[model samples]
Target: MFDWTRSCAYDEQQKRRFHTTARSRLKKLAAELALPPGSYDVRSNKAGVAVSGEVTLHHTAVYIQVGQFGMSSGHGILIRTCKGRKNYTGGANHFVALSMLDDIPALAAAVRAITGVGRADADSADRRAA
Candidate 1:
């Protein structure tokens, strides 16, 4: 429960709980992907008094919103990589919501595409081309 009426919006305890919930969801996907340690970090951003009402996955090129607290976000994950990334029909740069555990597989794929962690990098691509 986040208190938006307060100046800081949330307390240290609330912050820890929020982060834990977010990270646990992410870790479940990470375990599936076998991502190496420190492959990603869950950082916070300001959104009025709600500290991290919005979150970024270490990339500014894309945006994501993890739904929680029965807010409009719901219990889903939103990602903005839906130009042929998944079955999403959203416009380019628009976030597609995957709101259930059944969508985890799709979410996992979306996560990989957005983060570029499990995907081959420039060097690997170059080596393959050579």
Candidate 2:
């Protein structure tokens, strides 16, 4: 038997872990944006793999892609949402490359600009939904 129960449990654990990691990464962002962490929803398609996985922020309407950095092969995060993609390293509007877990103040600001939705508004909407 493949033990689907165990597999499901493992998958859920991985998802939770990824969400936790995402929460940690977004903690400061939530503060800066004045958005509540509970209002942010996270989903991963790569079994919540720490590297090369896709994590989508559904409620916040953001996508986080983490994997090998360009040219350097170092780990980094690439945010994909709205119209274009933001690489780990690129122009001023581009994402920042990370050899490790780097804070995302700039990225969050970029997201704010791209989404054109303020945290206060998002927070209000989330509260209304709740």
Candidate 3:
């Protein structure tokens, strides 16, 4: 005999586990990037969990949100970014879904690309000043 109550309890437990896992992963990534402690906020959403924070990569300042939804292994990470108050009034400018748990490397690569451009611009400015 299948017990619906037991199934519900199991689902709740799994959701809690996913929330904790997602929160920890985001925190770890932020720490690795040297973001200020407590710069991000994690919360439970329709998705298993979600995290949002401001990240300045290169000279671009953007707000980012990552969310994980679903209980299946097929669940992936969703990233959304917004620049300036446009996030609130105009909405996000970018969105992507990464279908892997090990997306940290991809995230890091993006940051490097942005920062690399910033560095180039700074170098050009320095040369002009000299």
Question: On TM-score, who's better, 2 or 3?
Answer: 3
Residue 103 miss distance in model 1 (angstroms)? 4.9
- Regions of candidate 2 where Cα sits further than 4 Å from its true position: 1-23, 36-38, 45-51, 69-76, 80-95, 99-101, 119-130
Ranking by lDDT: 1, 2, 3
Query: If both were scored by lDDT, which would come out higher, candidate 1 or candidate 2?
Result: 1
lDDT of 3 by residue, 35-100 (tens): 554444444453322322122221123343443322243324433343433343223334434333
- How far is 57's C-alpha from truth in model 3 (Å)? 15
Candidate 1 residue 69 C-alpha distance from true site, Å: 12
TM-score of 1: 0.42
Candidate 1 Cα outliers beyond 4 Å, as residue runs: 1-18, 50-52, 59-94, 101-103, 112-130
Whole-structure CA lDDT of model 2:
0.46
Off by over 4 Å in 3: 1-10, 46-75, 83-99, 111-130
Query: In candidate 3, which residue pairs get closer than 3 Å at backbone N, Cα or C atoms, i.e. clash?
Result: none
Write the residue-wise lDDT of candidate 2 on 8-120 in tens digits: 22355654554456545655554655655665554455543433344444434444444333425443455544322232232233354542234355556665665553354
lDDT of 1 by residue, 1-130 (tens): 3332222345656555555555556556555545565544445444544554644343223334553333344434555532322323332442445343244456666766764434434564698799
> Which candidate gets the maximum TM-score versus the true structure?
3
- Choose the strongest candidate by lDDT: 1
Per-model C-alpha lDDT, please?
Answer: 0.47, 0.46, 0.39
